[model samples]
Target: MSQPLSVPESHPPPALIVVMGVSGSGKSTVGAGIAKAISRPFIDGDDLHPKSNVEKMSKGHPLTDQDRFPWLAIIRSTAERVCAEQAQSGEVNKGDRPAAVVVCSSLKKIYRDILRGQHPASTKMPPEDDTQERHPSGAHIPATAALKTYFIFLDGTEKVILDRMSARKGHFMKAGMLQSQLATLESPEGEEGVARVDIDATPDEVVAAARKAVKDMIGM
Candidate 1:
């Protein structure tokens, strides 16, 4: 009889997992699921949006790239901050690497690039000593050069998402604005570190798919 093959143990790396898609595609739900699976904190990008942006969206207006840039910056900074906190508190994965999951509308390639720390616009002023940087939680913020960013893009037909949007209540995003989001979306099909998951199935199925994608990405 042939000997059983040994499977190598996988260790999770320091990473920022961004759950991205147009509104009504279930980013928040999927992101939370992924975060729970990975034992990391989950952040909703909508909460980071400026009051003006929320008001605009509440009034059924689509945000421009200019309006989104600042919001994207906030998202990036928040991810970094979370990773830093994790590191300081020894709340990391088995590999001793910090990780965080976030939900963002990151519909454009440029927006994704900013999250990956590849875009100049996402740059911030360098601290004199990154090791000494402090978060509001009193955690030390270290340099995040080793942190990697990944995206799980929830994709589905407009009709499907529109139906979902119609069913949702009290959301600032209107079902009518789906067209604009689709128009702004540049498919991240070939983009590195992106796992596109189709969201046309039931909520449980979609979350399972997203969790699989995240596990595949992190080798968990």
Candidate 2:
């Protein structure tokens, strides 16, 4: 894992944590573990993908950028909705934010920017004009300020990931797609608010390392 960045003492905890990597990199497992440890919800990005994307992947086709924009938008909106609901629950303390862990491949830097609410063209959702108040229904508020997002990148070799993928069953993403994903991936190294965790260890070890990385990042 990379060295933990020096977060400012006054920085608020992340309101959305994205566990990102190529397929078969244990994003769902590690993300769920982190969410459980942090007392937050876990969302699988695959589950959020539209039916068409799933079908395309099931046929061994890689998703194009146009195919992913809408899906990324949904993921962003979901994170914001979770944050809004948590804020309204009155359970979170002052100056602290409610958080959720989500699994997304998030291969490219542009995709990551969209998730951070930095790319307006990627999503039509408007930013939160007022963070103090939210809709009564806890709708998709798209409050970038209220939702401080971070990414836990599960990094590993393509061979290792493909081997694991071959052993798995009932997953739409085939081992053949790993190459495309690697080609599309823009390493998140040196990017702000990203922590890279090596996935070569056992699942438990990886989870423990990921949790520690997250705690260290958020100053927990």
Tens-digit per-residue lDDT, 1-220, candidate 1 = 1111211123334688999998889998998898888788998877766555667899999877777765666566667776665765566644555777899888888888877765455444333232123223312222234568899999999989977776778765655578888998999988899999999898899999999998887764
**Which residue runs of candidate 2 sit more than 4 Å off their true CA positions?**
1-14, 50-62, 93-96, 122-139, 167-175
RMSD of each: 9.2, 7.7
Backbone clashes, candidate 1: 0
Q: Give the alpha-carbon lDDT of every model.
A: 0.72, 0.73
Q: What is the Cα-based lDDT of residue 27 in candidate 2?
A: 91
Report backbone clashes per prediction: 0, 0
Q: Mind giving the per-residue lDDT tens digits that candidate 2 earns over 26-112?
A: 998899899888887788766666556677999999877877775676576667766555655644555665777899989998888
Cα-based RMSD of candidate 2: 7.7
How does model 2 fare in lDDT? 0.73
Please report the candidate that would top TM-score against the real structure.
2
Per-model TM-score versus the true fold: 0.77, 0.77
